[model samples]
Target: MQSFGTSARVGYDSSAFYDRKIYAEPEEVEDGSSEENAVPELNRLYAHSSSSMHELPDNSVHLMVTSPPYNVGKDYDEDMSVEEYRRFLTEVWEETYRVLVHGGRACINVANVGRRPYLPLSAFITADMIDVGFLMRGQIIWNKQASAGSSCAWGSWRSPSNPVLRDVHEYILVFSKGDFARQKPECEQKQATIGRDNFLEWTKSVWEFAAESA
Candidate 1:
C-alpha cells in the first residue's frame, strides 16, 4: 500500500480526483479526513497526514505489491520532470525497505513513461532501488496482448527515424528487502517449489494474465 502525508497536492475543483476541502482540517492524512478515521481503507479521505516514507518501523510488512500513480494525468500527482519523478519513487522504495520483513518481497508494476520514447523508466527505477539497498530480483512483463496504447498508431510507422512503438506491455519489478532465509522449516521446502523458484531458465518475462484496464 502507499502512504500519503500532508505534503501531497490536491486540486479543489476536481471531484473526479479530489474534494475542495481536503487537507483543510485536523486530519490523519493530507486528504482532510479526521484523525479519528485513520485506517487503511480510509486513507484517501483523511487529512493532516504525517506518514513518512523513510522512517517506518522495521519488519512490519510481509509482502507488498502496488501500482502507484504515475504522476501523469492524475490530479493528486503534480506534474514533474522524469528525473524528479524518479527521486520521489526512490523515497517510496526506501520506506518499503524499512517496513518489510527480512524475507519480504515488494513487487512494483510500472509502465514506461515518455514524451519521447527513448526514456526507459522501468529500468531506471529498478536500478535506483538496487542503489538504495533493495536487491533486484528480476522483471516480468505484463503483456496486454490485444490492448493498444495511445501512441500505437505513431509507432506503426516503420521508418527508422520515427518515434518508438506504443507500449502495449508493462513491467513488474520483483525486489527483496534483505537477505532471506525461511523462518520456519516447512517454508524452506516451499521455496524450492516451481512457483517460488525464480532461478529456472525456461521462465518467460512476458505474462498475459491481465487486461488493459489494469
Candidate 2:
C-alpha cells in the first residue's frame, strides 16, 4: 500500500465524479488477455457490484460510491428483518473490502427510514463497516430538502403520542481499507475532477442537494 494522494478531492454531485462514456471492447492480445484484464471485471457501466466484485483483482478499486437497497419494501428490494438486512450487507461489504486497493475509499449513501419504529440505517451500516475491517473516516450529511411535505406524514398531528419526524437527509459514510496516507500516487489512482463551486460545497460535512427525480 503506497501513498496515493495527500489531499481529498470532493464533488457535490455524484454525476460529477464519474464519466458516463462507454469504453470500447478491449482488443485481445497475443496471449488472449484484453485491456479489461488489467483491472476489476466490475469496473464497468451498470454492474451488480456486490455480486460481481468477487471477480475483481484484489486492490484494484480506488474508490467505490454505492447506494445499497434500503429494504424498506421498495419494489426492487425484498423487505427483510433488521437483523437479516444487516447480515446481508455485511456479506456485501466483506467482498468490497477484499477488492479495494489498500487505502481505497468506500462511500456508502443510506437514509434512515420507518414509520412506527424508526430505524437508523446509516448508523447500523457505519457500525457494520467498522466491524468488518474498515477504518471509518468521515460521515457526511446529505440534506435532500424533504421537510416541506413531511407534515402530512407526521403520525400524531398536533398530538404528543409517538410523533415521528420527517427524514430529509441521508448519510455518506466514508471508510478506508487501510491507512489513507499509505495509498499509491494520485497518478496511479482514480481521481474526481470537480469545479470550484462543487469543490467548495463538497468540502462541508453537510451537503445540501435535491434528490434526482426518477
Candidate 3:
C-alpha cells in the first residue's frame, strides 16, 4: 500500500489530472484558491482509499471524494468475482460510515464494466453502501465522448447476435450518513466560490468532461 497527499486543484480551469470544483474557505486546509500559500498538508493515503481510511478518527471527516480501483484487472486489485468485489466494498463502506461526521457526504466515482457478460458494478456498490447505512442522494453521469471505446473494442460490430455498445461514461454516486438535515459546523468557516456558469453546468446530472490520461 502507498500513501500520499490529498488536495485537488480548486477554482478556475486547469488541465490537472484531478477534477476542478469551487471549494469552501479553508479552516484546517490552506486556501488553495490563492497562489501565495504553499501546498497544504492533506490527509490522504495512497493505499486502497477505503481500506486506509480506517486510520482516521470517528466523525472526523466532513466529505470524501474518491475514485476507487474498478477491479477490472487494475494493477492493484486482485482477480475476484463480482460477489467478492461486493463483499470488499462492504468493508470499505462500513469504515467510511464510521469515520464520516453526521450528515457527511461521500462521493464515489465508478462505472459498469463489460468483458463478455456486462456487470453493473455501480448498482451493486450503491446497494451495498445503502445497506451499510448510507442514504442515497444523487448521481452525476460523466460523459466522456473523447474516451469512447474504439472499433476494436466492439465485440461483433454491426452483427446483432453479439453487439457491444461503447463504454463512454462513468457515474459519480453521492451518499450521506445520518440525518440529511443535520448542520455541518464547517459551513461557517468555508464559503462557496462557485460562479453562475459553473453552478448551472455542475447542477445538471449529465456532465461532459475530458478524462485524465494515464
lDDT of each: 0.63, 0.73, 0.72
The model with the greater TM-score, 1 or 3, is: 3
lDDT of 2 by residue, 109-207 (tens): 988888667789999999998788788889999988853354546457776675557677889999987654443565557666898998988788998
Measured by lDDT, the strongest candidate is 2
Q: Which stretches of candidate 3 lie over 4 Å from their true place?
A: 1-49, 52-54, 152-155, 186-190
Kindly report which residue stretches of model 1 are placed more than 4 angstroms away from their true locations once superposed: 1-56, 115-117, 149-151, 155-163, 185-204, 212-214
Alpha-carbon lDDT of model 2: 0.73
Off by over 4 Å in 2: 1-37, 40-43, 46-49, 146-150, 160-162, 186-197
Worst 10 residues of 2 by lDDT: 27-36
TM-score of each: 0.61, 0.71, 0.72
| Deviation from truth (RMSD, Å), model 1 | 18.3
Candidate 3: which pairs clash?
3-46, 25-191
lDDT of 1: 0.63
The 10 consecutive residues of candidate 3 with the worst lDDT sum are: 29-38
**Count of steric clashes across candidates, in order:** 8, 7, 2
CA lDDT for candidate 3 = 0.72
Candidate 2 matches the true fold with a TM-score of: 0.71
| 1-214: candidate 3 lDDT, tens digit per residue | 1223436534543334233344232212211221111222365455545665645666667687877777888778889888888887788888887777777789999988886788888899888987787878889999998776466464576788866677789999998877554463553656779999999998899999889885
